[model samples]
Target: MSSKPLLLLTPALAVIGLLFGGGLALALLQSVGYLAALGQTTLTLDAYRQLLSDPVFGRSLLLTLWIAVASTAVSTLLALMAALTLRRSFRARPVATFIFQSNLPIPHLVGAIGILLLFSQSGFLARLSHLLGLIQQPADFPALVFDPYGLGIMLEYIWKS
Candidate 1:
């Protein structure tokens, strides 16, 4: 074969160059203040320093780690349970498989919204409770949507995953 490595490598090289080159350009622009608006050309390390020092960011990072750990642990347990359950033949296997596969086609965001609508204080559960005389009104419903410990996000991950 003729020596034509550049011709053979052009497409792959172009993709690699575009990805890294664009990332480097953006980084340089951000670092040098080139991307800033009018009269904001001052170069500083304030952004980096603030990011390193912020308490909220620190807590958020910790929360993210905990969420990831919890999700992984829960998913592993669930997968084990599913494996054990599937090991035994049952009449519900087809229905369970269908539900599991159906979930694959529904987007996570849609599931999150559905969960919110079903579990929120003014949601379907609350209405059902009121109709069953368990509660006087939606306002009397207990909190579930805006829980302080990120239950909603955790539930969404569990359902989606």
Candidate 2:
């Protein structure tokens, strides 16, 4: 067997291993307080212990879990409803299906970037809101992407799903 395909995939596989694996390793080391730069050579679980002990961290974890569950539930319900509607005989079924499935081809990364650009404080929606007198300025727009409630993240998950 020719090794051409393997050779072609070598670079991509190398990159994936180097970047993804290295990054994860570095993060793990740092999480365990093994950062050499800060003179933290000792491997310890103090960081994790502190995080688990912190009430804020607990609340944040709970909030994240809640958002994940809520978004998944909402997306499932919406998808089910859409599927049921599309299954029924209708004159515009083809068009509706086409519109619905159009986003399936888009990459999640691209969709996430689009969501950030459209939902951020200074994004198109905020600008439009300003022009429509909904808000005096972009700052007046509520935080979406980096909000405390992870609203933008949930929105992206729901949209992508």
Candidate 3:
């Protein structure tokens, strides 16, 4: 709000903008096949063309979009449900709210890793299940992490959200 503060922040902001902008520019140039170190200066869209033409790439793109949309929808619905539930006057509200908010500050990568560790085949749940005679071995646990539907990723996103 003050000129003095703006002046003081100008240098750091400029440095950050320059570094980030320059790196993005370099990446774009390299993506277009303009790597100077490798002696390739010609810009072309051959890489992108190849990528677009690949059948596997198309499938991967579709799967990624589906996963993103599904996770976002599920997370939004869960958040809405939680908000509605928490807004009411009820007993154990403090405990429930605390438990819900406890993971709010965790980073996405950390939460994802935590989910992986807790849900993987050899994870604690699997071991507990085995110990309880519910599962025969770690492999008997369901494939939640590396499953075909990206359920683990959605779980991480929803939980972190």
The CA lDDT of each predicted structure is 0.82, 0.92, 0.93
Q: What is the lDDT of candidate 2?
A: 0.92
> How do the predictions measure up, each by TM-score?
0.74, 0.67, 0.78
Each prediction's number of clashing residue pairs? 0, 0, 0
Model 3, 1-161: lDDT tens digits are 66999899999999999999999999999999999999999999999999999999988888899889999999899989999999999998999899999998999999989998999999988999999999999899999999878889988988988
Report the lDDT tens digits of candidate 1 across residue range 1-161: 76598799999999999999999997976875665656677777878788879999989888888878887788788878877887788999988877766777789899889889988888999999999999999868877678766667777778777
Which candidate number maximizes TM-score? 3
Return whichever of 1 and 2 wins on TM-score. 1
In candidate 1 the C-alpha lDDT for residue 48 amounts to 74
Which of the two candidates, 1 or 3, achieves a greater TM-score against the reference?
3
Best candidate per lDDT, number?
A: 3
**lDDT (0-100) at residue 151 of candidate 1?**
69
Tens digit of lDDT per residue, candidate 2, span 58-161? Answer: 89889989898999999999999999999999999999999889889899888889988999998889999999999999879999988988899898889988
TM-score of 2: 0.67
lDDT for model 1: 0.82
After superposition of all CA atoms, the RMSD between model 1 and the true structure is 4.0
Pick the winner on TM-score between candidates 2 and 3. 3
Instruction: Name every residue pair that clashes in candidate 2.
Output: none
